[model samples]
Target: MSAWAADRQRSRVRPGDPGWPSDVSWQQLNQQVGGALIKVESPIAACVEAPTSAACAQLFKSLRNPYFIGDDVALTQHLGWVDAWTSKPSAYAVAARNASDVAAAVHFARRNNLRLVVKGGGHSYQGTSNAADSLLVWTRRMNEIRLHDGFVAAGCGGHVAPQRAVSVGAGAVWAQVYDAVTTQRGAYVQGGGCTTVGVAGLVQSGGFGSFSKAFGTAAANLLEAEVVTADGQVRVANACTNPELFWGLKGGGGGSLGVITRLTLRVHELPEKFGAVDMSIKAASPEAFRRLIGLFIDFYGKRLMNPHWGEQVRLQTNNIMRVSMLCQGLDRGAAQHAWQPFLEAVSAAPGDFRFESSPVIVSMTARDYWVPTTLKRALGLVKVDDRPGAPISNMYWPGDQLTVGEFVHGFDSAWLPAALLRDDQREALSDALFASSRQWWISLYFNKGLAGGSAEAIDAAKDTATSPAVLDAFALAIIGAEEQPAYPGIAGHEPDLARGRRAAQGIARAVAELRKVAPNGGAYVAESNYFEPDWQRAYWGTNYPRLQAAKTQFDPEGLFFVHNGVGSEDWSADGFSRKA
Candidate 1:
């Protein structure tokens, strides 16, 4: 027999084996790495004897550790934050300090015939960052940000002149970037609202932000990236070098093509002033709520071409709705004048809809409005807030205006029926279905590139790998909320997996109904369903084939795999080839 075959047979742990790895083997393997290595523990036991034990405390502090194995509670909490359904048990974890470290981890896992998972920020809603019985390379500890004359260096430090860009570490959070630039240079990048979200994960999945109306998505702002391919070679992918890899990295979703180590992104000057407004409306009944939602959708359809206006509307089962907005370069007076028409329409509505400031728009600067939300906690970063609960939602890329009539049909056909289920029925239903019966939200992202005429607008087709559907989108929303039973469910800690599945189905059905209103429209990958029926078409649109080619070129071995990512069709959730 071959030497390798003999070694494999000797190490094999047959099913139901009493002891896997011969006890001492795990410790010996742990000692092989330079960074911290931790043996996974049970959170329940750890919490019971020592509620305030070091292990429990380490869960929050070890977020930036170079390496550590998470206990059951740590793993559960981490998974719970992003996705409850995608949670699974993991026995080992390694925190990589640099590209070489990553290469070693990859080698170790491959030689051991172990599944490997790459994690950044732990914010993958689809739970692609985790797997059962997998070796997880958590990159959160590889955080570094440096600034040079014109350019800023992230984890993999490099200096480039003309200084128009910032190189961000794969593990760096968006809040860090925002605070660094705005505090030092009065600048900012198009990034997510939440500060703790990792820049690499969001950018790779096509990120949008408050400034996207004027600047474009975080992916569009990307100029270059440094990634470690399956062969363990650290390659720099940029517009001029490894351009296809560059294209794929821009919006192909994280942990797919490779482990993104660093990113160089073009930065934009923040407006001298940032302004915002909030408006609230109450509907007496479901019919009124439908009308108000339709009117808001119509407003976005007409105002889609406006580059400086951004609005977010939330709808609830209690016949209540709210609107929040951000306007750049415009003072309070100018912003009010610009939004007068929309304000007038709200007042004319049959529902009790009005601005927070009656008959006028009250705009506040970023300092006055946004900063106070966190009570001067962390500079530049929003206070760490919980993510929306067991959200079963999808993006609605509206191509045209939606009337109150159409809005009524949408709610009646897609939403209201789900919400009408009894509390017991909702509980009995899968988490996916129960969560789908929640609240509805509409987020308006103005695409300047699609708006035409603006020199700043990105050409969705040519600029990056982001879905072109966003280019034509007038009002995009993830409009589902949980009500019958609170999401993450009443259990609080242990999540309902069955409910998660049902919620997935509900989201799919909801998407199908919304698609009828805009058949040609597509969904956003980051805010989309985990099991989207035609995920490739929904996330990448016409860019799928190109992204697929890039995936094959850079990762032919399929080393970096994630569900719903490009070329993911070849692999099942367990890292097994579906073709087999």
Candidate 2:
């Protein structure tokens, strides 16, 4: 056998070998590519009963926490890089400039028995973009955008390029797309509020935005995609070719079946400048808070049937309920006219409250509209190097007006105050939670009473893998502890395992309590609690079987996996490895 092959054989201990890359093994691998193909890893904990080698000890001491992330090559090659919220590190990272590069990376990962992670924008909340002991394929170098007839094709890593029908790269952020399309193409795309969020991840996660009422969801607008499946074959998925894959790609949740390299999205014309009414109401006491919540829910019920309307309601720890709205195709006058009923409801509320109106013609294209409100401000309070992921849950209001009002009052009155921490504990966690308060925020996307048969309407009969609950939903609700980490979904990486367990359990309790009100409703897969009891039922509902079938066909080897993603239940949550 060759010297390198012999070295590799020697390196493989009988389940007791040192986890060290010998000099010979490194030399041989590097020589094949004229240089290092893989860098030395930081000294991770060795498996039990590992063989002790002097060289391994030296390597460990000399190169503590060895990782390629800071190397010059890594800096240039890595596209939009980010680590985990818990600071978990990937074993190695490789950049893909083309489909072939992606295929090569896949092959190398499989051969080396390394977990593979595909990162387009690196904005995954659950930290799926950076997996421990995994090979990360960075797609940032593949940035290229092309416009074609009737459609636009975007490289997965490229900036957003717009046409009459825009094509957005998977890595392209919402702000970039808005800037490219709004002025040049005279169109607006439905996307998340944050500018830095990736189009690919958002769309694949059942995304919605201000214009959702008029334009449907970002997933619903997906026209086609180019993907590299588990077997390392580059494939095209659309209405006609690979239709099943296309359906799965629409909103089966990101990183499930394959690495999406490009996306073709359907863009709509700008109906009118976006207009909204901003109103804030504060209650003098807890009883007033209940009344304010009831009024807000009543307003939501009134406007829920308007396809061109959407509302964001926030219940703050200081007993403040803020309501902001977006009325697509409505001017300032039209919005005022439409909001009269809501205004009346608030005015007639029983409580000591003050309603402050900051009505402005906030153009959607303007910076003010794009700025994230409470969540962003809250994120800024406990500033860290990188923005952490949030723990979130989606609740749909399936009740009538009276039922919704009752549900809202009950949740705000019964659950929120009870779950809040005492003043002493609140002070300790104040940085993590902006106000040391427990808050529940809801953004209701009026999907009902939409102009039926309109191209923009969400069709339940459509084959996309997005949750069936989204089509029949009334609102998206998120409840979180203010004094906790801003990204509510991340239970946190406590050094004490027991402490971590308690923290997670606390979050699970809150989630369970909130779920009680929306028992019959489904959740948006993208912004949901990580510890969802029956995730399949909560996220995909009855559509889980079809999504699973598609996953089996495209990735029978279970190459691509993410937490809470389709077929992810088959794997262990701890390492995403196959279950015994």
Candidate 3:
């Protein structure tokens, strides 16, 4: 057999394999990284050893706090998904504090023929950050932030004009960046809606926030990045330098291209006010719920399909509709006026609808929107980290609390085309939505779709590696179910396998209903189903071939691999061996 064929047959060295590194080798690596190497253990190790101990109790309590989860070397934001994956700690981790440290770890892992994993905020729903018997490059300590008034890429001095931007370390979360950019400086940077999600991961995954309709995706706003490629070479990628690598980094999925140490993103002018609308409407029967869905779809297409509105609306099995949408550049009165016509239509049919409560329309100063004090003291819509001595800014939305360390039963998403909102097609679209909700709750996330965005926002998203489908999509319909933190080996906290399987089935059926209308719809890689069959096409569309070429150029040896990420089809399911 040829050398290439022989190499393809070999698997990465495991813990007990003869090719595994010796104790001296590990010690040498530790010294090279300034003694930042860590001997990892399961986050629940203490709980397993002594379930009744005070330390174990405290650890379990800390699991519910996203800040605590992100700070640990072994834990991921999600514990795992049922049957799909379980968070497993690597045998060792190099707690990377800088690009040089990350490069050193990469060199060691490649030379040792070891499985490698990279983690930042550890928020991958597909469990890309955790693997057993591997060596981890953990970038949780590289948090730093800097603002630039007129930034230009290194090699684009004259060709590219200077622009306002922010440089953020991989470990910095959205909350930190928003506090610095929006609250402190009164500027805006597009990022994830979840406060604790890592900046690097979200940007790499084509991030969406409450204001994405106005600012575009996080990846599209990327100005430059500092990356450590598989060959341990630290390179700067931008529009003018290493352009191919730069294109791949935007929406190509994290942990596949390289380890991103820092990213620079373009900043936009902050609007005067940020606002939200919350209300619940219950339909007396299934017939009324169908009409309600049809009415909202028509209203959304006519009035709300613009740069101002974003966020989600929910269609539930209990014949109820919930609205938790947001807006920017519009104050209380304008937001209210935009929705008055729809509210009046519902009120006219009292025999079919009942209001759970009066619609709450409110607006606040744009600068104070992300302030912890505003969410806690003024709005009472957030849950603060109660641990003594924690930073006062450590707060998350009350609605987001359920996802911290959650054991997901199932999750799936699909982009609904803007064409579906036409008067001729509204009935088919509404029928699919109402049918899907019978099996599971359907959430229509309008911000994730860029169809009716500003021309600047749409053009920016077109330049990134994200699926082309998003450009014409009015909303991303997400169907999912989950249970609370349930890691294996914890007696009472173990996953309910039987129940999870049933939920998974319902999630599948719900997605099937949507497929009947949007047969070839593309999915968002960041929130797609773990068992997606045609992932390459589903995630990247025509962009997959270009992404593969970039992957081959940068990582010909296939050193970096993540589940369903770019070029991942070349490796085995567990990413330990190349497919023969």
TM-score between model 3 and native: 0.98
lDDT of 3 by residue, 62-138 (tens): 89999989888989999999989999999999999999999999999889888999999899999998998999999
User: By how many angstroms RMSD does model 2 differ from the true structure?
Assistant: 12.0
Quick one: best TM-score, which candidate? 3
Please state the error at residue 291 of candidate 1 in Å.
Answer: 4.0
Q: 258, model 1: CA deviation in Å?
A: 0.8
- Which pairs of residues collide in model 3? none
RMSD of each: 9.9, 12.0, 1.6
Off by over 4 Å in 2: 1-85, 152-164, 348-351, 356-455, 481-510
Relative to the unseen true structure, what is the C-alpha lDDT of residue 28 in candidate 2, on a scale of 0 to 100? 51
Ranking the candidates on TM-score from highest down gives 3, 1, 2
Over the stretch 1-580, how does candidate 1's per-residue lDDT look in tens digits?
9975654433322223443344465565556567445554434344445545676454334322211222122242133321434345455777667776677666666555556677776555566767766667767767677554465333334534455777778877765676566655566667775555678888898877766657777888787788888777788887667889888888888888888888887777667667666667776666555666555544554553466766465554465666666677778888777667777777776445544434335554443333324343334312332234411111111211121001011111111121212344332222322222243333333331243213465563357888776665544646432211111321333344555445444545645545444565566776555546688887788999999898888877676777778877776655634343
Off by over 4 Å in 1: 1-33, 42-84, 151-161, 285-287, 348-455, 481-492, 496-509
TM-score of 2: 0.69
